[model samples]
Target: MTRTPSVSVVFVCHDGAGRILLARRSTRARDEPGTWDCGAGALEFGETFEQAVAREVIEEYGTGPEKIELLGVRNVLRPGSHWVAIVFAVRLDPAEARIGEPHKFDELGWFDPAELPSPAHSQLPETVALFT
Candidate 1:
């Protein structure tokens, strides 16, 4: 059976500066363990994009988004899978953000967009570029 493309909500949680938050996925993560990625998750059946963004951020970061703006959408197709991701620029106090899920993320940090950490998630660069 052919699987339908998944819908995801992505958030670039920024500190109102040029720095964006990235989390290093732990070994328990599905695809890219040890790779840095912005906060994202599959959108639940009844959740709105904004709601998913808020829920995912809080679930992953331990804090809520103070402000969220729709950036754009990305249609991603890999060899055997696809997804449409609705991206958003989320502003939150960097101090308030922490690793809420230790099993999912090993480390989290804020970095300059121009100097992102190594071993980043494959789609992170392009997904981040959509903000500008």
Candidate 2:
């Protein structure tokens, strides 16, 4: 039996200015260890898109979304995983953001769009570019 492509919610957290929050993947991360990436998670079976985005944001950053907008969608594919990502532009208080899941993320920071950190996750640049 073949498996179906899953759904994921990718949120770009901004401070309503120009700084976007990014988290560095820890060595124990599922993929792309030591790479900076936006907050993301699988879309649950019965949850709405906004709900998924909000949950992921809070779970990863210790903050909730103040405002959320549907940016666009991207079809992400790898050797063993395929998913349609629902991209979102979320606004939140940067002061309330932290590494909620330290086991998965090692560092978190707010960066200007033009001065992003090096060695970002393979899909992060494009994902973030969509909202820019």
Candidate 3:
């Protein structure tokens, strides 16, 4: 069987202070429920990786890309599947960011780089390391 290829995005926002946005996954998600992850999601059919990243930001955070910088890409393989994620360094004014309804996430909040929560997944550590 041919496994489906998946793409995800990691959004990092900083203020020269040492913090990044992290979201708590909803229990309803198929995998890694309740884990803290950077804003991310799979690429939809007929969408470019960049388009998927922009769409995910709107769907999850209700914001558009105003000044997003491409960080790098990382390929990760789990036990049953693989992923290619485009990580981006994004800067959003805190005042303009409103947490969307928890349709896919239980909670969303910002965390200091030194105090990030545990159980990070999907190359999040690498993404964070790039920013810090």
- Best candidate according to TM-score: 2
* Residue-level lDDT tens digits of model 3 in 28-131: 86678877777767778898767777787777777776667888887878888778867887776666665674766877778887777876655567778767
Off by over 4 Å in 1: none
> lDDT for each of the candidates?
0.93, 0.93, 0.73
Model 1 residue 96 lDDT score: 97
RMSD of 2: 0.7
Rate residue 12 of model 3 by lDDT.
Answer: 75
* Candidate 3 segments whose C-alpha is farther than 4 A from its true place: 15-17, 45-48
Could you give candidate 1's per-residue lDDT for residues 2-53 as a string of tens digits? 6999999999999998799999999999888999999899999999899999
Rank all candidate structures by their TM-score, best first, as comma-separated numbers.
Answer: 2, 1, 3
User: What TM-score, computed on C-alpha atoms, does each candidate reach?
Assistant: 0.96, 0.97, 0.81
All candidates: CA RMSD in angstroms?
Answer: 1.0, 0.7, 2.3
Judge candidate 2 at residue 44 and give its lDDT.
Answer: 96
How much is the lDDT of residue 112 in candidate 1? 87
**Better model by lDDT, 2 or 3?**
2
* Residue 65 local lDDT, model 2: 95
lDDT of 1 at 35: 97
Model 1: per-residue Cα lDDT at residue 2: 69
Candidate 3, residue 60: how far the Cα is off, in Å:
0.4
